[model samples]
Target: MALAGKAAVVIWNDVTPEARSDFLAWHGREHVPERVSIAGFRRGRRGRAVSGGPEFFTLYEVENEAFLGGAYLRRLNDPTPWTRRVMPAFRQASRALCRVEFSLGAGVGGFVATAVLPELADADGAFRSALQRTAEALFAAQSALTGLHLLRCDANASREKTAEHGLRRETPELPAGVLLAEAGDAAPLADVVAGFSEKMASETGRRFEAGRIAIYRLELCLAAGEVLPPWDGSPTFAGEGD
Candidate 1:
């Protein structure tokens, strides 16, 4: 499919384990399919914490900004007790999304997907710091990145199940290379990957593995309430307004 405009990557961090179960069940059961029903939406993918995230990371993509800003907002404000409870309890450390001004090459597609982040000498802090530096560099370089999200997984157990989640099955391998980036075109993206590989090799004194990693894209679907799609690998949307 041609690249859609106005894509977004949302990172949601759970305040507690109790919240994690609710969030995942809700998204899989109610939210995703709802978003898919909306007009103008094309395809959407959901990602779980294969490597790094706040317990979990869900990516949404849509065709228009209004669904995210207006329609989505309204759903969050719905006064129904169920809506009220799920809406307010959620916490966000950071949320970022942007339009696709330019890009080349299609999203990596396969049964297993892995992203290799630099193996920091300081495993705890190095990955996070490198991620931040990369994001800043991309923005400063006038890259086409529209969104940014950084998360620390709540537990290693969660990473194994990332692919079982509906959206994550697209790439089902352990991560090695960068998870996210902005590209102006195919040439720039190629340059970025080459430079990134070189930088990692020099810093860690080892060449980063490629077959273990893959490129993946995201989409958001928003529709009125409905039964969410099954985890058969189909894309969906759930309406959490605004």
Candidate 2:
């Protein structure tokens, strides 16, 4: 399916093991719903790593790049009490504010593969054309690949500090670019994603580090219209199921 919007914020972070449950509660009960409630936001998806990379990955689709600096940034600067409670436990957090460069899909798959692709020093129209062609070929070869998205990171936009960032323990990271592929099962993407990674690297004449690529099972999903449980401003850790 086409994305809900033109741009998205992709994040990768590891929460302290001791705070995992609280993190889950904060994310599902308070975070996702709150973010989607913003005017330009569309949908949110949270995933838990089943194979590699960080413990959690979250994607928030927004109407366009402008919203990142507008309502979104405003919300970031004024965090809720629950947000403040959970933010301090975040670690190794990397975030990217991105424009959807290329995407192909019919539906949201049960599983997704995440990887950070290096930036192209002098990318041009021809480079984008090549990227689409490569994506099409890769899509055609793997039936399990139900959805795929390529995001071009806006480093400047992503690097801005906010109240939330100030609460984190470690420094924030900016990814060069990001690739997301969704499939019904994890097996098909294991080799195909690495292959695409290599081909993409070949296009840029750069080394593709596939080590960060990971397969995650979809854990939480929220949409703009979904009804969220009321947040009473308490710091209770409620799991998604709760």
Candidate 3:
């Protein structure tokens, strides 16, 4: 199980309950396609919280950190009318552009348990070393864990340009580090991650605040050449050409 790509861009947000349906429609029909069509994008996956935390999550795998500033930013700057309409409806949006430091897994799964840890004052070398050690320990403990990826936020690559489109909820502060573990079932994986968190804290004397773990069920996943269901009766945007 090698890493999927050099970097991953993650977006987590809560959509107003009233806008949930349309939000999902736009994401599946327009957003995912538009992103994956970009040259460096490998895949795009979206998930919804099955347990606790934000209602929506999206992950985009890109060739490298440079892709964030290249093709990706160009799209972000030019929003479709539908994108313009849907952007403002997102609440508590948090975006992160991350460098994929380590990954261990054979394949993706139906569910993912993610742990977002706050930044520490430690130097980059020490911080990455600690995360690697913890991730290795977790992998050794659970065989069903299909993927364990550690992402370090690349602050310069993160942006909130959507604000210009009137979708201006303050971006949540980026996590210093993110851990994503995939599994067939959410419940058991959640428990495993919890225990792993405890072990990491106890051994290292570092406290990752509780309630930061979220479990999500895969909702939409797309890659190049996949046919997207027609956006029947959905709102249209002028010049929506991908």
Best by lDDT: 2
The parts of candidate 2 lying over 4 Å away from their true place are 170-172, 202-211, 231-242
Clashing pairs in 3: none
Tens digits of per-residue lDDT, candidate 3, 1-242, equal 54558999888889888887888888999989989888778899999999776888888888888777766777787888888888788888888888887888877878987778685334367656776787888887887887888677866557545433356474647788677888877767777767766766765676744347788999888876676767786567878886
Give me the displacement of residue 123 in model 1, in angstroms: 34
List the candidates ranked by TM-score, beginning with the highest. 2, 3, 1
Q: Model 2 over residues 53-153: C-alpha lDDT tens digits?
A: 68888999888888888788999899999889888899888888899888899888888898877554345776787788879999988887888888888
Error of model 2, residue 188, in angstroms:
1.5
Task: List lDDT for all candidates, in order.
Answer: 0.41, 0.83, 0.77
Off by over 4 Å in 1: 1-3, 79-83, 87-92, 107-242
lDDT of 2 at 170: 45
Give lDDT: candidate 2, residue 161.
85
Ranking by lDDT: 2, 3, 1
lDDT of 1 at 15: 40
**Candidate 1 TM-score, C-alpha based:** 0.44
Clashes of each: 33, 2, 0
Best by TM-score: 2
